[model samples]
Target: MPWQHKIAYLIGKPVGISLSNGQGTSGILCDVSNGKLLVLEYLYQSQFALKQYDFHMIQDINGFPPCMSQRLY
Candidate 1:
């Protein structure tokens, strides 16, 4: 299976997404299928919305409480 399919296991979990356009967004990973990503973004108190993104536009993906692979110091 492709790496994207592996992300399906993280469904319902919050994640940070980096886009090819140099933009970034974080949200709950709702679903991933057919080269599409469904994210649930929090707009405000008691308000939320779902956004769809093309899988191809994604540059990187990281989960919350990010961990560094290398020492910064």
Candidate 2:
């Protein structure tokens, strides 16, 4: 599929991914590109502290969008 169509169709789904800094969290796939994925509502730990996160994208899931539904309900 086209990149635009892939991005547009990737807005709502769950993806199993990790951060570049070695953190773990799961959320809806909000956006995508050839090099990253915009994941919403992410979670991770840093500097010995727990943190809430948003807008995280890594290099693993690069071309393929999340293979799940975005809706939580």
Candidate 3:
């Protein structure tokens, strides 16, 4: 399995996602399948519906409490 497949285990858990475009968001990993990702909601999104994004856009998974990562700058 690829790294993304392993990350699928995060389902139902909160994780920080850094996109290739340098944008970031945190949400519950609701689903990861068929080249798509379904998150419960981004950190700044107020609606409770799941949001979808292309799996390829995901650059990294910053784990829970994502702020633990060292600053890149």
Ranking of candidates on TM-score, top first: 1, 3, 2
Candidate 1 clashes between residue pairs 3 or more apart in a chain or in different chains: none
- Full-model lDDT for every candidate: 0.85, 0.49, 0.77
- The deviation in Å at residue 43 for candidate 2 is 8.1
Candidate scoring better on lDDT of 2 and 3: 3
Q: Write the per-residue lDDT of candidate 2 for residues 1-73, one digit (tens) a residue.
A: 3233444555676555555577656666766544455666544553232233333433233234445867788
Q: What shift in Å separates residue 19 of candidate 3 from its native position after superposition? A: 0.3
TM-score of each: 0.76, 0.36, 0.70
- Give lDDT for model 1: 0.85
The lowest-lDDT stretch of 10 consecutive residues in candidate 2 is 46-55
- Writing each residue's lDDT as its tens digit, candidate 1 over 9-63 gives 7688899888999999999999887788899999998999999999889887777
Task: Please give me the total number of clashing residue pairs in predicted model 2.
Answer: 0
**Candidate 3 overall lDDT versus native:** 0.77
lDDT of 3 at 52: 83
Which candidate leads the pack in TM-score? 1
* Clash totals for all candidate models: 0, 0, 0
Model 1 scores a TM of 0.76
